[model samples]
Target: MTPPTPAIVTQSAVRPLPRWALLLLCIAYVVPGFVGRDPWKSADVTAFGYMLELAQQRTPWLAPLLGGMAPETEGLLPYWLGAWAIQITPSWLLSPEMAVRVPFAALLVITLMATWYGVYYLARSPGAQPVAFAFGGEANPPDYARAIADGALLALIACLGLAQLSHEVTSYLVQLSCTALLFFAVAAMPHRTVAPAIALVVGMLGLTLAGAPALATLLGVGSVVLVVLAPGSSTDRRLPWTLALAAITVVAALVAWKLDLWRWRIVGANSGGKEWQSLARLLLWFGWPAWPLALWTLWRWRKQIFSRQGHRHLLLPLWFSAVSIAATLTTQPADRALLLGLPALAALAAFALPTLRRSVGALIDWFTLLFFTVSALAIWVIWIAMQTGVPAKPAANVAKLAPGFVPQFSALALVVALAATAGWCVLVWWRASRDRAPIWKSLVLPAGGAALGWVLLMTLWLPLLDYARSYGPQVRAVQAVLGADPGCVQTVGLSRAQVAALQYHGNLTLERAGLQDECNWLVADMESWPASERMVNAARWERMAVVPRPTDKNDHLLVFRRAAR
Candidate 1:
């Protein structure tokens, strides 16, 4: 038997958030990082490298390679999407770097939309609805569901980990978006059929193509089990849906097998004390604010969660979140694996709103207000230090961290940052002065504060971040040593990101170390200098210069010019 739900919400507390404000908040969150940033270090640039290779017609469509090294991730759809975006966009209108980001940005937007709808459907479940009052003042189901959905979205945006990874053009973001779609399909299955069925197929197939066939299969099978075990699921009503889901799951598995995309990458959990502590830290901060609320939801919904009534509104998200958390423990890149669980976590967090006491909500509001205000002030101070050197220590820290960086001021960026600051102030005022009756009021400061910090960093600290995180400055230093039109440069032991940086920023043609008969210059990683000597005739090549990446002194390159015979 199902226990009484803990929620006792009223009609007044379910007031809808304005549609315009929600749209504007989403736009503010989605647009900034995609627009004015370089393809950053490691994964971001490496993925962009593969996409650039495909766009330049230098790599096969089925298999992309950079400097003869294939991408480490087992997915090709992300690269295809980026390459397609680059190919279709005219260069005069948008550079390939900017064009590649457009689709990933859309994927993030879709993830947000799918998450909202998924939470709405879950909140509409009979078991999740608020209690009826003797006076008939209980919150209407639709209004309450919408209010819950609004809170879920705000929680997702406020997760600290989501800001950076979601903005990158990587397979992980694709997987995350597809996971949200699958989650929506499963949650909406009982009430709808056609659209949910279509979403299920697309979601499953998308997961297969996006390098997470295992996750797709697990989630699909789990949904089937939940449906069969659900109360009042007459065999007649359940069998057809079960069979259809099973068929789609089988087809998805077959597609993955045919494409040879299956990879067993489980790296098991690390038992080392420090590694465990690091992971613990990651979990704590990465899901901040949301994690605490999710825990609160579980506590309040404990009886419903464990009851025989099969309260799927809680069960489904718990399953999804559990699967992702399990993967995070066993995976190599733990953070990306954990990212797939966030939408479900946020959904779980939303359910806590109906049960939270006034004191608890006030505590959340006060903590968020204090935390983000200090963060914003710190960013502003650093920016001021970089511009005018008003505070000596922050400027000194910047110079020490990113050596040889020349700071430049942009009036446009400053105006945007100031405008965002003003908007944040207005939002704080609204939250502080207005009635706190709305269920989502508690999350307003957290979401707005998160957006404010992101905007400030993207506008105020963009140049500094680019200089520290990007390969542009390093590439330019190499070009300075090579002079104009250094043709057909041979490379040895260069990383995929370095090769891509050279091609994009230096515009230099590259050949393998032993393969370039006509090349006059060679660039080799300092660590691979021995291999360079073995590959080339040492007498014919003379050392030119050793160029170090400004941010990392240990990471330097050896430049060589072919000696005149």
Candidate 2:
């Protein structure tokens, strides 16, 4: 027998957020950090380096390399996508940086779209729906689903973890997109639409191509089981798309293995005692508001959740979250692995909306209002201090952190920030005074506030962030030391960020310095002088110059010239 409905929502609570408002929020969230930002250090720069190589035909398509180092074994598809975007984009219309971002930006949008649709389908399930009123004034199932979907989307946007990573030009975003697509496919399995089947195929294949074959396999298998075992499932009784889903995943897994696409980062990246503690901390805060409500959803619906009927609604997201957490624990940097689960967390959070007591909802509203309002105020104050030197403290802190950062005023940016702030105010006022609002009302402010803060940062603090994160400052230092007509440089233990900077900013070709490789100059950190000596014929090369990044004393490059080789 089907479990009784766990939701206790009413018709009045199913009010839909305005379409225009939702559209504007998404535009505001996705557009920033895309324009006017250089590729940041570490993984972002390293990935861009490979993409540039592929686009310029400097590296073969099958194998990508950055500064002569092998391409990332875990992610080849993201590089290919970015490279193709760069090659196809017209140089006159957009810069190489901006051109590459076009597709990654779309991937983030795809992620959001999948999430909205995923929750829409899941919330439509019989077990997921709210109770019918005795007086015959209950919510329409479809309308209730739409309202919950809106809340899920807002929760996703408000997530602190998604702020920086979603905007980044990285493979992680591609994984996240596919994860959401898988969610959409699984959630919509019972519906009579071609969308779910197509999503199933694309989602499975996309995850494999994106260098997450293991997760793809797990999610695909779990989804099939989730569909087939769902009690009272209309699809389970008459049709068996679950088997089709299983078949699709099997093909995806085989294709990945056949192509040798699966990578092994878990071998040496296992978590230790401290690392486990750190992972726990990451899990607690990464998804923030979503995690708390997700826990609430599990507790409130614990009995129904494991039951056949409720499993349809709860387990799909739970499986996704479980696999993502597993991936997070196993991966070297957990953030990227953790990104794949945000959509699932948001979906689970959406279920908690109906069960929320009035007091609980009020508390959520008050906390979100205070938190975001304060954050927006701080961002505005910092921008003012940086621009006018009124308070002097925040400006001093900026100088201390990002020395030599000269803050500039942009009228357009300021206008955008002011508009978003105004929007937040209107949303707040509407929430506070209005008595009868939708179930999703509590989250509206938090989402808008998060977007407002992001806009402020991208506008007012972009320069300072670029100063700290970009390798331009050090790249300039390296070039200054090289003087004119510097020969090809052989690198000894140069990090990916440094290598990418030398290739992009300095337009210098780099190779590994070894007995087999012949080059005139060597570049590496001075601290590694002894190691650098081992790579080249030290007797034949003399010290050339030491170039130091002005802001960071430890960041200096030791250059060596071949002794008339």
Candidate 3:
């Protein structure tokens, strides 16, 4: 008998995802949590407010220019999108919440699509496909596994960094999503054609629009190098030259627009030398829990780290991590740098997953279970303590304490804890069954855990932040005293946080007080209280209220108002 010919795989024979299904999956993966809470105090809302004002023609395009902050700092694209959203949405539908969030929501969806495409292309690259096929085996082709892996990556991106940044309405998410697309195009480019050049242009536009001209220039240079150095025909040689010139021109234009020649003054200068070490610690904190696994993977894969095939896929993540860390170390506020590393880490995590599945798979599952269980317990305990008014750190030798002092916890806490524990158990059992399999076992626990964590944060963590955002009931109490009198409320010696909270949540327009008639209410910190009261030429106002400072200092909110007429 003649040997059967190997099945000829045609394009139609390969199952491709339906367009509608893909669109729905993208949406499902990328939608931000609609908790309707503003937790960053005012940064996000204030930026949106300015954008809204500009849209309403109350401000000029040069409004941001007044401060010399580029419209591109947060990227011009999202702002333009937000501006259009405000202009088109009916006034009744245009609440501060809706105005800021809608554009981000749309971008969030785009981010998911970008991530999926990036990972798919990266996996389907010539270097990657054989390994994927070998890992999957003929009995089960790797296509479905590849899709699932990409989906998991997309899901993780949406759940963790992307979700938080987009919902919080920061510029980081926009930049991150753009960077992902850039990497996708770079990885997927076929040598000896205009395809790589097109990808480079798209990436360059994305970076320019996302507000990082300097970094974008670097990426453009890298792209040229990648194309020129790729093993291919002589025709491919000319492509890089053309791409480099185009990228350079775009970079120059963006630089000019951002006024790169100007020397920007540093605000809130930190002269202390402790910042360098603090930044390192902060990086660890931000990377938290995820970095350990990433480090472990790197050590395990040290041999493959610099291999020819691995190098292409590895370059982007490595560069991303290095640049972000360097930036954080050099910057005044290190927290902002945390956002830069998230995408790199997420990508690294995705690449690391298969390896994890092959080795110590059971251990990872068990550890994850333990982590969730401990996390749930800790959250519940904290919730209970907060509800019962039990001091987190009680004073020694204190006397009077209340009766029936049992701590109370929210039902949500118990539900989350149980769910986490159950999920962990399920994951552990599933992994155990497939311990010997070469196939990629579905590891949904990490993604599920992240999702659950986000829910907890939105519902529980945000409400706690409300205390800080509400100006410690200062705004509410002031309103009670003033009762809608125009110019009746003013703040004295307020911190930026206090002023911001007043502006965003209280719906008040505030300016510094020069004279008593400037406004009625005055808020002051302890040190500045005397100066503020003196500046306003007021003896004292009604003692409206007092609240503890939201942070870890023995601070109090002493709300004094000018006597009501």
The most accurate candidate by TM-score is: 1
Q: After superposition, how far is residue 4 of candidate 3 from its true place, in Å?
A: 31
The residue pairs in collision within model 3 are 490-521, 492-523, 541-561
- lDDT of each residue in 5-111, candidate 2, tens digit only: 67887788898998999999999999998888888877788888888999999888877878778756456788899899999999999887788899999999999
Off by over 4 Å in 3: 1-33, 65-83, 130-163, 191-211, 231-249, 252-277, 288-310, 354-359, 380-429, 435-443, 460-462, 468-472, 488-497, 515-518, 523-565
- Model 1 over residues 1-565: C-alpha lDDT tens digits? 5699899999999999999999989998999899988989878998998998998899998888899888888788899999999999999999999999999999999899999999998898889999999989999999999999999999999999999999999999999999999999888877788877877888889988989999999999999988887664467877888898899999989998998889998885666788778789889988888999999999999999989888888999999999998888888698999999999999999999999998999899899999999999999999999999879999999999998988889999999899989999999899888588999998888989889999999999999999988889889999999999888899988998888888887889988888337799999899987674557776778999998888988788889999998
Using TM-score as the measure, what is the rank order of every candidate, best first? 1, 2, 3
TM-score, model 2 to reference = 0.94
TM of each candidate vs. truth: 0.97, 0.94, 0.72
Model 3: worst 10 consecutive residues (lDDT sum):
395-404
lDDT (Cα, tens digit) per residue for candidate 3, span 1-565: 2122112222222243345534543443344254345535445644564555557664455434211233425455555656677788887966755766777776556555555555555544333332323333332234633543453353344334444555656566566656665665665565323644554565566656655565566565665564454432255554755466456546645654674422221344258867656765776656644455556546655554555433444465556666666656655335655565655555555555444533455665566566655665555555545565455533111111321123334566457546545654564575467344332233344454554455555544454544444343555554564457546455666655555455555666565655645465665565565664446665646666664444324445556666765
Full-model lDDT for every candidate: 0.90, 0.83, 0.51
Off by over 4 Å in 2: 234-240, 267-273, 515-520, 532-534, 542-545, 548-555, 562-565
Highest lDDT against the true fold, candidate: 1
